[model samples]
Target: MQLTTFTDYGLRMLMYLAAQPEQQCSVREVADHYGISRNHLVKVAHRLSQLGFIDSTKGRGGGIRLSGEPASMRLGDIVLKLEPNMHIVECFDKSTNCCAITAICKAKDFFRQANQAFIDVLNKYTLSDTIVSGKSFLEIFALPQPTNPDRHKQS
Candidate 1:
């Protein structure tokens, strides 16, 4: 039930952005912060932007920011969008299923139930829910926490 490295990067990027919703961050900055490959992050950023998860600006002073409120974005939906494949087993994808017991594979139903349960848990949470402490996150990341005056009002 492990997420792909690409999805991991996407999540990381989102977390970093979540911490600084008011500020735009460069893909290089995020990669450097996480000590990951900037090239890979660039691709992730581009995909996230294309998927409408993040907004990107080109040229000087240009960077990226979350497209909408973090609390409104569900984790399950985000994972589904970021992950290219959610099929846990070969039988899940009927188009290329090679399992011999496809007709009466009892285990397939169990796997499907388990997978649904996993997503159900994720669906219960939102991007904002990941940040347990905003101040601590900003302190650790050395990012300035911009004062969102209307933050209290949003709740």
Candidate 2:
């Protein structure tokens, strides 16, 4: 199932925030780094904040940040909240199902299972999981690299 642009931008915003846990990130910063629409990102940020996924503050020195630890934010849970419809087939939604064979079509069951499987895999991962190779991820945003706590000791 293809995710909508809304979901894509939301996930990008989350990933960017997850990578910069120590500071408040602006919507413009995130949007500029990704070369996406800042206007669109604003809507996603508002929804994310409303959903308690991120915290937002306005005015001077104000921006957005993840409300929870990245490790605790499951990818599947985020997707479920951001994605309006998860139906993989036309028959999935009873109200919208117009396919004649929906009643007898075993295809619905198969598609349902496929959709669940997709979510199950995502459930196994968290926002932190997405930033596993965070050095590269950080570089993309032109943000300062996180100083390794053990760096001084190593030297």
Taking every candidate in turn, the Cα RMSD to the unseen true structure, in Å, is: 10.0, 10.1
**Cα error of candidate 1 at position 76, Å:** 0.5
Error of 1 at 23 (Å): 0.4
How does candidate 1 fare on TM-score?
A: 0.87
Off by over 4 Å in 1: 142-155
lDDT of 1 at 118: 83
lDDT of 1 at 9: 89
Q: Per-residue lDDT for 31-138 in model 1, tens only?
A: 877767799899999999999999999999999999999899888888888985789999999899999999987999999899888878999998899887656766
Error of 2 at 113 (Å): 0.7
TM-score of 2: 0.87
Q: For every model shown, what is its TM-score relative to the native structure? A: 0.87, 0.87
